[model samples]
Target: MRLLPRLLIILFVIFAPLPAFAVNPDEMLSDPALEARARTLSAELRCMVCQNQSIDDSNADLAKDLRLLVRERITDGDSDDEVLNYIVSRYGEFVLLKPRFSVRTLLLWGAPVLLILAGGIALIVFARKRAGKPTGSKLTEDEKARLAELLEK
Candidate 1:
């Protein structure tokens, strides 16, 4: 029916994922290889303005500038590492979408595992203490004598 088709269309319009690449046509490199590399690098770099989003996914002005800088570096024949180092030098390690593991980041990478292990150990200790405890109190000598006398009577 016509109504069914219109409802389906409306649902599709509401639910369909639209393309959301933030790169403008002018920002793209002419060379296919360089453009691909630039895109890859852009995806790794964090947008300063939109701290949670990668430069590739962010529509921020700073993201645009970072994209341009990546393209410029790739065109200048800098290796991937060189380009990353250059950016890190300028913006600090926080500019990377994924922070590189190093001695400085050891605590950040290890804290969760350490915490989970500590929690498991604590839980085991608590369970042991609970299991070892007697649920009912032992009867005193007077209570035992009273119980025996009551039974005889």
Candidate 2:
């Protein structure tokens, strides 16, 4: 009976949703809609200091500054597109979590496929060369005779 309560408490603790933001309580917008938009924008912005983490998930000082800048832009009545454009203009496309598809990004995305195709072609060529013939020259008649004589011994 006591185990049931303990198990319930453990399950509740294990399954509870933890807070997801590194945004301080003081940094949050009072307007829930604006705050939600800020959160969304923050999530889309990459943390330059922590390359793999979104600004919203990063605890870096630069990320915090970016969060504040986003909120400031929102409060200044910038549309979501305007804010994103401003950030991109300031920080370049690399600051975006999902970069816009463009010529440069297309190259970045396509280079690996191109490399793999090249590698596969090289591998096929190599395999064909390897399969074409045995690696060494055929033994001469004299060498064969000597090999047979040695084997008999």
Q: How well is each residue in 12-31 modelled by candidate 2, as lDDT tens digits?
A: 89878765678999999999
- Which candidate number has the best TM-score? 1
TM-score per candidate, chains pooled = 0.81, 0.73
Pairs that collide in candidate 2 are none
State the lDDT of candidate 1 residue by residue for 1-153, as single tens digits. Answer: 789999999999987887588999999999998999998999899999999989999999999999999999999999999999999999999999888999988998899999999999999999999998889989999999999999999
Runs in model 2 deviating more than 4 A are 1-20, 135-153
lDDT of each model, Cα atoms only?
0.93, 0.95
Residue 100 lDDT (model 1) = 95
